[model samples]
Target: MNWALTNYERLLDLVWQHTWISGSAIALGFALALPVGWAAYAMKSSPHGAVRQLSGVTVSLSSVLYTIPSLPLFVIMPTILGLGWLNPINVLIALVIYAFAIMVRGVVDALNAVPPSVLDSAAACGFSRGQRAISVTLPLAGPVMLAALRVVSVSTVSLLSIGALVGVSNLGSLFTNGFNRNFPTEILTGVVLTVALALVFDLLLVAAGRLLMPWNSVVSAGGSA
Candidate 1:
């Protein structure tokens, strides 16, 4: 605690850097996942055999990509992107790829869970495909999507520390520094702060979900209680 308080400024900077990296990755991953997930969901039900197989291929590909070891991926990012080894962009891009892999499958599952009857009703009420997707389908799928997003948020926060291993400053630096110095206090501080950061992100996501989907809050309350 004394160490943390004495180095409060440094700790705060690490926290901010971690937040920026994790938040950006989550945002970019979701942006990229939406269309791909939707396409996978849409294509899986297609009459064409080859087109239907594409969804399975995509899900498999994402899984394979995710299985590549994170440390190696971080180290290899510079080689792949033509960036300097220590560039934060390498870490940022790696995290985004991971988030996308995790969330894209979730998006497919969430969209699949939407009721066909609801979609038919929306169509009957004169909603076009785009309009229905924006107003009806997405809203109906929001709870599931939110659940997936919360997972991504927590996972990203936890993983952002790995960037420190590659010389991109973040909370994980505390781990390496503490280990080198044989300082248990610093290592424990890092663990506590990392978990706390992940929890904060999880709580914020839950609050946002409740605000955006009040009915879901009611359902969850009733179901849990």
Candidate 2:
């Protein structure tokens, strides 16, 4: 802690870079996930079995993207994107892909979890497809979607650390710096701050979800009663 305090300014700069790289990727990933998730859910809900097959295939590809080894991706992203080897943009893009992969499937599952009766009720009310999706489906699915956001945010923050191995300046750089100097404090600081960031982000998502959809809790409580 003393060592960290001594170098607190440097640490703050790294934190800002780390947060920017990871947070931007997460934001982009979440934006892309909405449509991908909707497509998966829409196909699955369709009567055509072949169209349903596409949904499974889409999600499987996302899972595959996530399973790729991170170090190699960091190394190769520069060549693939024509960027400098150590550019933070490479790290950002890589994290975005991973975040999108995780959230897309999660969002699909959330949409699928919407009760059939509620869907039918929405339809009976003469709700158009767009209206039902925006008003009824997304509102009811908020809990699960927010749960996905929590997981994706944490995962993105953690995964972005891997980019530091290739010289991207995030919190993960502390591990490298500590190792080179054989100083445990730097490494420990990284671990603590990274975990703290993840926890804070997760809690914010939970709070936002509850605030945005108070009716969800009310209905859940009534259902239990």
- Going through the candidates in order, what is the number of backbone clashes in each? 0, 0
Candidate whose lDDT is highest: 1
lDDT to native, each model: 0.90, 0.88
Q: For candidate 2, write residues 23-51 as lDDT tens digits.
A: 89888998998899889888986799999
Predicted candidate 1 versus true structure: per-residue lDDT over 66-172, tens digit per residue? 78888899999999999998889999999999989988998998998999999999999999999999999998888898888888888888888988889999999
Single out the weakest 10-residue window by summed lDDT for candidate 1: 216-225
TM-score of each: 0.94, 0.94
RMSD of each: 2.6, 1.7
Q: How far is candidate 2 from the true structure (C-alpha RMSD, Å)?
A: 1.7
Report the error of model 1 at residue 104, Å.
0.7
